[model samples]
Target: MTTPVLYLFGSAAPPVADVAGVITDAQHRGFDVCLGLTPTAARWLAPQLTELERLTGHPVRSEYKMPGTPDVWPKADVIALAPATFNTVNSWALGLTHDFVVGVVAEGIGKRIPTVTMPCVNAAYVQHRQFERSVSELRSMGVRVLYGEDGFQPNQPGQGHPSEYPWHLVLEAAVEMHQG
Candidate 1:
């Protein structure tokens, strides 16, 4: 039997520093991991692309392919958006497909694919009225929004530590969804 495919989406949050670790963990958990990064996140992680590709045996993607081009990655059995930033959450909720990451996620929801998102926003961003509404919108669409006490709690404004971003929780959620 083939291992399940996980399309891991990453946004430009500090926790993205540990994305390599997440990829490694996913592989250990029996997933074929494919990485998709938002533009800023791609730039932030550029130096590690070769290593990341080596680990996953797939190229890291951060932009949409041109029309008529064949997709390189396999279709995902599940999608996990970790270190999902406030901007990405809002953009996705608003159905903005301006970037590759959001575009794929939006399409995934439309396809009713199992999707999970774990935001890495601080307290100040969470306070924004749009943040809560965005989370609600995603949940309504059947996407697992991993926020709150059971998932990710907002850190105090300007007090977030990237190392504490619960990357494992997001991976676990995705794995559970895939297994079930």
Candidate 2:
């Protein structure tokens, strides 16, 4: 089976735990999962987050510190950035690539690869003018920016599993790419 590279970017926000469930589900579906974490997210999850790397059999990239030399990343089949933070989104839209997570995005951009960014930020930020512009630019560049059908509300009352994330949508898109 061809391994599909799945890059998952996280933030330190409270939604990280809920977002973790989505990433975990993706791994169970057989994608080679990568946990591209920022400093705060790394600190929040600490070592337990290692489960993703071990379970998916993929090395996690958190820090930008070079280990003598930069390691080359294998070609990615799909890149998904969930819970993309305000800072991260703006940085990517502005082409500011420094941290490991942002660097991965920059490389992915250079490769002309398929990318998905799902921002789970405050509703206010989502409504912000600049944020809307960034989303527009990302969409124009062919990046799939998913705001879910309605929105993601953790522990939402009467929420059923099916009503949560539309993972089937992601799978459908993945299948289309493979078929094409």
Candidate 3:
């Protein structure tokens, strides 16, 4: 059986050493994923490591590709942006789709796909008035924005670790999204 296509928009561009486990976890739960990342993420993570073509049977593009060129964009059934950094989160909230990650999300919205975001910004940014408004705006647009236990987590130590895992929340949200 073919798994439904899911696209992950992530900002953990710093080659999170342990991300394979999480990707495998999502795959096992019934998804063939296509990964989109910011340039920073590319530096931190391996493009091949994300398992785009291997899993989805399509090219995973993090940048704008030539239109006439033949590349199959995985037909995303669900779109989730996890570990969403403050920069990306604010852009997404404001409907600014310049970056590839947000661009794909904007495309998802245009397609009426089930979408979710799990933000992991710094505590200060998460507490900012503008940030809160953006979250509200995203929610109003039917986008599920999962907050950390209390707010955002900037990968700080000794601050209650797993409680701030936005990726896990995205995983959970993806299950329901695919099911629905």
Candidate 4:
């Protein structure tokens, strides 16, 4: 059986640091992983870019391919954006496709691709009324947004436990979504 391709996207959040481990876990669960990052995340992981590519056997993509350029990564069977930041979630919900990662997930909604996202936001950010609206909008659009009690709970600013971000839950949801 062909391994399913997982497009694992990350934003510039603390939990993004654990993306390598998340990739390994996805691979163990029978996914052929392809990594995409927000521009800031790309910079954050710049030192490990080559190594991450080696780990996934595909180019790590941060920028959009130029028009007429053939896409390099395989078509994704499932897409998961973990450590999705406040800006990413809102941008995607509002159809703002400025960056590569958010652009894909935003488009994924219309493409009917099985997609999931777990936000890595602090409580302070959550207090903004727009945050709940964005989350609700994404949910209404059929994107499985793992937030609040079911996913990443917002920690107080400066008190987050990045190591405890629920990557396992995100991966589990991806597997389930792909299976269906």
**Which prediction has the highest TM-score against the true structure?**
4
Q: In model 4, what lDDT does residue 133 have?
A: 97
- In candidate 2, what are the lDDT values of residues 1-180, reduced to their tens digit? 776766777765555665456666776677766677877877777766678566656566678756798554556787776567777877788788867787777677778777876665665566667877887777788777776463343333333243344444454454344345
What is candidate 4's lDDT per residue for 33-88, written digit by digit as tens? 99999999999999999999999999999999999999999999999998999999
What TM-score against the true fold does each predicted structure earn? Answer: 0.98, 0.77, 0.82, 0.99
Model 3 over residues 55-158: C-alpha lDDT tens digits?
Answer: 54555556877779865665789987876777787788787877888887867776889998877665556566888888888788888888745434455433
What lDDT, from 0 to 1, does candidate 3 have?
0.70
Please state the error at residue 75 of candidate 1 in Å. Answer: 0.4
Q: Give the distance in Å from residue 85's predicted Cα in candidate 2 to where it truly belongs.
A: 1.3
Q: Rank the candidates by TM-score, best first.
A: 4, 1, 3, 2
| Ranked candidates, highest lDDT first | 4, 1, 3, 2
Runs in model 2 lying further than 4 Å from the true structure: 65-73, 148-180
Worst ten in a row by lDDT for model 4: 147-156
Which should have the higher lDDT, number 1 or number 2?
1
Candidate number with greatest lDDT: 4
